[model samples]
Target: MKQLIIILFLVVIGCRNETKSDEEIDETVYDMWGDFTQVHPEFKKDELPESWYFHDNKEDANRLADLVMKGKKKASSGLYLWYKEANADLPKAGTKSIITNFDGTAQAIIKITKVDTIPFNQISKEYAAMDMGTNIEPLKKWKKAHWDFFANTMKQGGNEPTEKILVVCERFETIWPKKQ
Candidate 1:
């Protein structure tokens, strides 16, 4: 009788141990976002997607933003850089230029010397006039400068236009946690 009792006790303890181990493993698998929040306390109350790792403090947030911005700029610059290299042998003024996304999923074909107007309603009618001409030189310069500024500001914890865009995109890419 004692032998049987001892065997049952051991079996119970083993089952409990197995349960505990499973719980720990599950916690570990989901801890990446939790760990990020711990490091960045400011985001403790902010709602975020499961995949997003946001920082709480201004400094840390800035650092992450910078990294993301740099990545975006690198991606955009590569598009224009390729255009310049491809037309190196062609005449400068008449060369056609095209910039495509890294995945080659989207492209914009632009002609040099054509002027395009961008109107802004947020600003006064006189203040919102932006003429983007189809000069390859100016276009490339604008793209580089715009990307650099955006990346740097994002790194410094400033909000960016792209952030909203990312949020919409994430709905499709991420598997949201079930409601508690």
Candidate 2:
């Protein structure tokens, strides 16, 4: 009885000390944003960029994110229907985003340089190559991977994936974690 209560109290205190408070987490993100603005000095301090990671799978997401940090993968695409169905705003040029790791820690900041809506079948070989992580037949790889991803997304939205479906393509530059 008394021994059980003492053990529970010790566990609670230990957990509280080990866990990061919300303010501490927010400060980490804020510090990253601040570090970014220090180099550019054009972006305001109060407006924090949207933070997100790529891909649904954790390992895939981390790999893609690291590629972005390395400045190898400069572009990406998403199914427009996914945004519409979710009522999410479509990405636009000039907007900044904090690309995060699968664990939700900031990896780099990117500024969208271009945004275009293209039919899935119409994505150019050059653009597909830019979006891919590998040097091999990038267009083929991009088509296979994006097709599977878009099909899954469309199925969840109660829609069917088609070659004519629009994809929001974006090109960005990693502005933070600058060249050392």
> Which numbered prediction scores highest in TM-score against the true structure?
2
lDDT, each prediction: 0.26, 0.70
Candidate 2 C-alpha lDDT tens digits along 1-180: 444433322222101112234554444466788887777687765578766667655787788878888988888887665555445577778888777766667788888899888999999988887788577898899999888866764555456889999888888888886334
Could you tell me which residue pairs clash in candidate 2? Answer: none
Backbone clashes in model 1, listed as residue pairs: 40-56, 42-56, 66-155, 113-134
lDDT of 2 at 131: 84
User: What's model 2's lDDT at 101?
Assistant: 65
How much does each candidate deviate from the true structure in C-alpha RMSD? 25.1, 11.5
